[model samples]
Target: MNEISSILAICGACISFYIGAGFATMQEVVQYEASYGSRFLIVILVAAAIYLYTNISFATNGNRLKLNRGGDIYGVYCGVFGEKIGKCAAMFFDYFSAFFCFMSFVVMCGGANSTLTQQWGAPFGVGAVTLTVLVVVTVVFGLQGIVNALSKIGPIIIAMILLVSVVTSVTGWGNFTGNLTKIDQGTYADVMQQVGGGNPLASGASYGGFVILWFAAFLSELGAKNKLKDVNIGMLLSAIFIFFAAGVCCVALIGHIDATAAADIPALVLAEQISPVVAVAFAIIICAGIYTSATPLLWTAVRKLADEGTVKYKAITVLAGAVGCGIACFVPYKELINVLYGLNGYLGFVLVFAMVAYDLRTKMSLKHGVENETAGIDR
Candidate 1:
């Protein structure tokens, strides 16, 4: 692929990967739109810009490290953090991925069940089984194959969302303009109240926590364990995609019923409103996203346990899948989201600190900063 295609592919992977079950519904926007309010877009823009910068920065260093897997980079950061603390952080982050992945798996089932139940009175058990099978097919193909397919499907997801939202609004005979005007009038404040946080000030600690969590969600750095093509474009494209996604979600929020539901899963809710076909499209999109979240989780866990043998490799993958599937069975959809978000927030705090320390060390050798050069292979 040429530079443009390469970058877009990277971009597709980075941005589309994050558009998981949570993002499509309303979790992402609620964090920004509800907690942050009209100011939410500002946070979305800023977060996208910062994430874009970090992605590029990470790629620049990761390629130099040529570390083969992301855990190596984590090791470097861990060393700088003091072996004890660093190892602890890595363990926390790595395992968290597994927990998050399983939770998402269950959610995909719930989402599919939700759609099926709403249509043709189909039993949820059948829908859940179907969704699980579909996910396994994609996983069996491994990350590269999925990425290849997503390079096409990712943008299509975005386009379809935009098309649905725009078409819906237009067909509304321009009530879109007036209907959206209600958004700024304080509907967000009410929604947060329903979600366990009364108001931003009252829930200051809680909402502040979410801002931090969003930062931690960016763990893979575009899955650039070693070298990826179109390094710079890949990341920038992700930023733009995120910004666009945030906008589409908000439009759905302002246009839909549960103006308060804006905080939930706006995409799926919006899809349900647009048409049954739209809902199915969103379901497929959610499944695709769950795959994205599932990866870093499985990769992190498997890396810790497996060595260079096929015996260990297959073992790790199965373990990861089993653990994740088990969690899906037990965890409630929204509770899982809250836990993931909170965990991301705390981890983000540490990562940002690492980012700062790394920057300082890079600028001053006296600080003993590692330039992300491959230090040594991990055992």
Candidate 2:
């Protein structure tokens, strides 16, 4: 791909990957950041700063390393802490990718089933099966197919979200003010305590950490295929886009805090107020976002286990999808998400710490070399 197309593809992939079932449905925002009231603003700004720096680092460092397997970079940095432990952790995280993707797939399936049943009286089983089949077919084609699917779906979802956010903000300005008033009445301490584990800073930091883990391997592959400058620019643009889109969405959701607070699909509730047709349209967009997100995740997990373009790889993909569907059907989707993702977020923090240490050491070494070279020239 040319630089422009590569950049766009990277941008699309980043957005689509991050805006999974919870994000598109606004459940992530509502739970992670929004429910905290005024504290969410702190979360947004802090998380954005961390996201911007981390994503740029992921691209640049990943391009420099040119990793063959995603876990290889961990081996490079984790040498100080017993290579065996590091490699084991890396492998563990790789396997965890499947678990994460599986949960997301289930969440999306459940979301689709609920939306369809509520809107059109469609059977939940039918919706779940249909979404699972489509996702499986998309994953069977491998990385290129996943990227193509996401590149198409990502922009449409972003546009629809931006439109909904803007319109809702304008029409619900009064409610927005009312919500803000409600938030202002509560102390920040009380707000954070009520939200996630009584610590707003921890919640915000975990959000950044969890997101970095999500993109670590996937972005490494993406960055390897493109020029460093292009990847850097793409990441910068993607960060800005997310910041704007997220801000608007959060504002929209807060506008009708009471209704959305209890909603399974908060965005759907907001959309329905505008029109039933718009709500249905938003549900489709949610499914597309889910597909885009799940495709890469499934590919990432499968690639770890089997070589691409092989019969074994194809077989694994189908089997994995089938297992995932069965799990989705049996598990209570929301409860699984709460437990799995919450635990993953903490684990992700450890990886973030390692990354920061490695980066700082590398920078200091480069600076030391530069100073020595200058002294030699002076001599």
Candidate 3:
């Protein structure tokens, strides 16, 4: 086994895994892609670009700024907003991230369950329990374990997805040719064909363009220290892979069969056409992807609580997971996906705030330095 840095692995994992769960799922294929506001595959690719930027920046800031958690990261904002506003906003983003974290875990568990049972022979609940244990175990090791997975399994999974899809497409060249053409004519109704039926992603709200840009910045920040610089390049590469692999695969399955964009596991929908067995394997991989996606958010949220100096991590993790499981029991799994995604998107307002804070910090540092220089000259 070749040795690799854990941070790079995690960064690669999230880059490939974050938007990936939705990539082949009904919501991703039809809702986010064909049916949503922009209703374009281009939008997803662009979103991937935004994701790459923001996450990488955040991580870089975390490292360069000694930002272990939200406190260090938010210090820039505090310098700008005069503490009060900055603190409130920081608290909001952190808590909101945590809430979303809980929501993500639920969605992952549900998706994993549905995939295992529907695509594989395993019972749905079995998948849920298994994932629950996995999240707890992985996160207990904290960021290191997460980073290890990101660096190691992340690239392999990315390769697997591409390799499988490419093989499938080339082998079935006849289907690929026609399906590729059909995708050019995308629509809202086309997305409605999936499992979690929703009217596509739409919002009447606006936060100027900052929401979009801030998200872009945050995404770029997500890359771990080692692979941080590769974010933008990685996203562009990943986006092309995502669009062609996911979109084309969906079309192949429909093949003039008329399928909904809403199928929860659209990849599996496509995978089945190749082989029922392969489809099951695809579902397992997806389930693992969900686990990969959900755990980070969950760990971060609990870690935030610990960083506040308010709680024990073990206790906090248990409490947080318990709350998530409770909600999972009641909230319909499909709806949870929409709610969590929209909620995260709502953070656009604060993106500008985070940026301004950063700018102010730098300016103040420069100004203070120049004043000291002037004092020396006068003396």
Candidate 4:
């Protein structure tokens, strides 16, 4: 891949992976960050740092190792353990990606279904099936097609979200100030407790882990194909994009907590409160976010099983879509967000630990090598 093209593609893919329906609609942010009230900014900053560190590490290692699949990453890091344990970890990593992708696709379906039901008075199943069909068709064209589509659509989605968040914050200035006053009065702990359901630190850590795991495998291949500097640059730029988009959404949601507390999609709630036109525009953006994320995830899952461009790949894609659509019917949108995503966030921490350990070990070995070489030369 051309360096510039690869970098752009990687950036696009990263954004697309990170910004799903819940994220675009501000549900994830509210649950993970904004709900922390006065402490949310600290959590957000920490989350950003974690994201930056893990993504940069993944890109650098991926470039150094040139891995083809997610499983390869585990093997590379886990090899310090026994071979049998390393093999087991590698298998778990590969298969887990498929599971994660399927569940994410389900989330996309459920989120779109919720949107359709709320806005158009349509049946939830209609939205679910429609999203699944679109995602499967996109995946059939293979990874390149998914990457190209996300590269084009991801920025537009982010821009629309940022625009809506800014508008909400501006128009709902009273809500923001009122909440800020409450926080300033030292009711921060109470506000945070009521807004977010759990511990802010754990929530932030999980968010960081989830984002890194989402892109780790795909980025490894992406990093391998591009120059290291390009990969680093691409991830750095994308990290900034995610940070801004997420931060804006969190602020908007926190600003309007009273109005948004009961709403399924808080961003949409605030947008509709602003105007019907903005609401409609944001609904489309939400779908786009869900689409961009779902398409690539489905491809990642299926490609783990079948080679791209093969008949088997296409067939499995269809099978996977159908299964995902069927499963999407069983889970409520909220439960999927809290339960499924929460589970993934914790599971992601395992990968984070492994990567950190690998980095430390490598640094120590490099230091030892230099020290030994210097001593031998002096002797």
Q: Model 1, range 1-379, lDDT digits (tens) per residue?
A: 6767777776776555555555655554565454443444555555555565555545655565554554455454445576577777666654554344444455555544544554446764554555555555555554465466556656766666576666544544344445444445655444442222323332233333333222232333334542455756666676676667666555555555344343345556666667878777765666556555444334434544564345666565665555555555555555666655555544544565665566466557535653434322233
lDDT of 3 at 247: 54
By lDDT, highest first, what's the ranking?
4, 2, 1, 3
State each candidate's clash count. 8, 0, 33, 0
If scored against the real structure, what TM-score would every candidate get? 0.76, 0.89, 0.73, 0.89
Off by over 4 Å in 4: 1-5, 180-197, 366-379
Q: Tens digit of lDDT per residue, candidate 2, span 1-379?
A: 8889988887887788877777788877776677666677777787787788777776766677666655345454453345566666656665675566556666666656665666678866665677778887888887777777787678788889888888887777788777866755652333222335736677677666667666766777666666888877877777788778878887888787767776767888889878989998998888777777777777776777787788998898888777766666666545555566666667766777766776776688677873121110101
Superior candidate under TM-score, 1 versus 2: 2
Q: Runs in model 2 with CA error above 4 Å?
A: 181-195, 367-379
Could you give me the TM-score of model 4 versus the true structure?
0.89
Expressed as tens digits, the lDDT of each residue in 1-379 for candidate 4 is 7878877877877787778878877777876777666677766776788888877777777776666654355566655455677667767876786778778889888898888888778877888899898999899997677788888787788888888888787776667767866554545443232322456678777777666556766777667666889878877888889888777776787687777755778878988878899998888888889998888788878878888889999999999999998887888887788777777877777777777877777678777883221110101
RMSD of each: 4.7, 5.4, 6.7, 5.2
Q: Can you list the residue pairs that collide in candidate 4?
A: none
Error of 4 at 356 (Å): 1.0
Candidate that scores best on lDDT: 4
User: How far in Å is the alpha carbon of 54 misplaced in model 2?
Assistant: 2.5
What CA RMSD would candidate 3 show?
A: 6.7
| Model 4 RMSD vs true structure | 5.2
